[model samples]
Target: MARYIDAEKLKCSIDSETDSIFDWDMTIEELYYNLCKLIDDEPTADVQPVKRGTWENTNTPNQLRCSNCEIIHFIAQYPHGEINYCPNCGARMDGVLSE
Candidate 1:
């Protein structure tokens, strides 16, 4: 899964490595690739995982609501079990399977 990393922290890491690891033979491109690898090795908390939500039936027919953010959405029919994500909040709509 792809996730975000702290860009400022990554920049600091690159800056610190630039002076210590560079040599007369090491090209800038090599340094860039090395930094990319280093950043990939480190984990940073820049964003939370995708939020989870469950489908809740609404008063109106063929309408479902997100349990997490309470965003209502219209659908073709009831029993909206196929929907896996909330359009408004980008939450994974799977409380039953997740729990």
Candidate 2:
């Protein structure tokens, strides 16, 4: 199973301990990855996990995407509300844009 770390939580953690010296140069994703390394935690997902088992099983839409990794997932493979994590890169599948 893929693991997802909340981006907001991670950002708060980083901001509380770090000075402004490195903040200007880093993107959220960069800060997330670096923080994960420092704390030995799972990397942050670009978006929140989709609520699994929430989508109807039949005719589920197949257009969800991972904004960070840019990977598309097959919607039918997951049970509705059961696909919180991305299979490709372990990113949260929530807020996946339709494309």
Taken over the whole model, the C-alpha lDDT of each candidate is 0.76, 0.58
Off by over 4 Å in 2: 1-61, 94-99
lDDT of 2 by residue, 1-99 (tens): 666677677667667767632477889887777765755553656666543321122233565555556565676677675677767666655554443
- Could you tell me how far off, in angstroms, the CA of residue 5 lies in candidate 2 after the best superposition? 17
Window of ten residues with lowest summed lDDT in model 2: 51-60
Candidate 2 has what TM-score? 0.32
TM-score, every prediction: 0.46, 0.32
Q: In order, how many clashes per candidate? A: 0, 12
Q: How accurate is candidate 1 locally (lDDT)?
A: 0.76
Q: What does the lDDT read for residue 98 in candidate 1?
A: 21
Clash list (residue pairs), candidate 1: none
